[model samples]
Target: MGSSLSTPGASNANDRPAVAATLPPAGCPMHRKLEDATANVSPPPSAETNIDPRNNIPSLSQNPAYGQTIALPLERMRSSIPRTLSDLSTASEHESASTCPMARGGPSRTTEETKDTWVYPSPQQFYNALVRKGWETPVQAIPVMVDIHNWMNEAVWQEVLRWERRYFNPKQSNLALEPEEIPEVSLARFQGRPQDLSPKARFHMLLGRIFPNVYSELPPFDRHDWMVRRDGWGAEEQDKLHRYVIDYYSGADDEDGNPVFHFDVRPAIDDLDSLTARLQEWARIKRETWLGEEQSSITKDAKINN
Candidate 1:
């Protein structure tokens, strides 16, 4: 169910061009319309996938959907496994590490624009993670896979920022926030909850049954809960941690034969203030875009009559 962005064989170099046009504007959340529009282009299913918490590698697990069973002998698989850090190959010494992003600190390493940028795992560490997960991945593919893993993380962070901006820059929000207030937003941590359904899933399922055609998309291929810390409010709201949910969805293939994907990112309904802020943001956009256009059209007609 994972997109080429997360899957092993789906090369990022080949897939990105096809979906580049579908990407959202700077800091804006992905437009949900792509969910159905690209549904028919989904790539053929690969392995049943869930991300590794450490490096976010799209893990390959035993699934008949892959159509190929693990055939390597247990002894053969264990033979090449590095037992210690010293045994691991130095990524910098190899060519695979050249184009790939390193685990360097700061925003330069990731799509994040703040000091709290995400760090990509080193190629050696990424390989170690695959071995630990017992995946039958080829050594040559680690560079490509690691590239995709890091790219997906950036995509996830972008999704989170869409929600964070509402609170981080509340003055622009429709909510009644003080004009002087500026919140310092930082990522506290990331928690993978692949097995658990987010609270919103139940409500979506209920709605799907009522209107199957409207909400016919499958359950999220993967889910993540991210904790974001916000500070600099007033005494009443010192430092606060807001939880956000990211749902990964795969759609039909793109022109390059790579699967397209959508990341549904939003603040979890756990915080009443956040939920209210989200609704207000939606309302603000509706007024400024759809209703505002209608009003402008009416005014033009009246002026012409005069």
Candidate 2:
């Protein structure tokens, strides 16, 4: 029986003589039929396929779904193999995230942005993006404040809508181009107080708004409030601060008919004339800076076009 499997010529005793007689010297039909029948016979089991009766050897003839799943050997292998060094799978366990993270669009290093690496889109790009996101108006009176303490906060999205609406109806806002209404929230979290930013914060906001030329390194100078900080500065800084204070409190009054300039550091900047002079100078410098930048940008652009 063993010899019959290995040798084409070997046959069982009862049919040996008849089989030999039917076989022709040169490839007869009977011989061809015999060869065809045995052509796909599997090789003897080795260590890899050393399956026992307890093991389920998946057969295509017995099972055919999903067009086909893994072959019996591979199925057993997939169940048995360990993936990483930390995997405690012992030739048996298979389930959950341990299979293959990469196969399922797992964390892609190539596509993810790094920490503190978000490059802001340009104003035009930002407006376009907002429009794309279904915002009816994408313009804003000011940059939207987006610092939220937690995921539960729903105010951020509302703020975006408010900002967008203000673009269409600038006059609807209580906040003037010069910031008549001071909101107690920081447009950015870094302003220390989330709301009602310090004088310093207000200054930067104004600066950025007015001078649209250098959006890169150069700070902003909005047409509105051009100053911040009532304290913490030397002669020039303090002088400018005092002048801003005066202008900011220009029209209000108290019960006794005194001015409503009750902010701290008023004592330090009592010189009205010097404060006025410094404020005037600050305004002049700010205007000149914006103009200079605008001119330089126009010239640079012309040169490029030429």
Best candidate according to TM-score: 1
Q: CA RMSD for every model?
A: 15.1, 38.1
What TM-score number comes out for model 1?
Answer: 0.52
- What is the alpha-carbon lDDT for the whole of candidate 1? 0.41
> Per-residue lDDT of 109-158 in model 1, one digit per residue for the tens?
22222333334545444443334333344445454455454555555554
Model 1 poorest 10 in a row by lDDT: 297-306
Tens-digit lDDT track of model 2 for 135-239 = 332133102211101110122222222222222222343224343432211111001111233343355335546654421122111111111222222334432
**Model 2 has how many clashing residue pairs?**
19
The parts of candidate 1 lying over 4 Å away from their true place are 1-116, 167-171, 174-182, 235-237, 281-306
TM-score of each: 0.52, 0.14
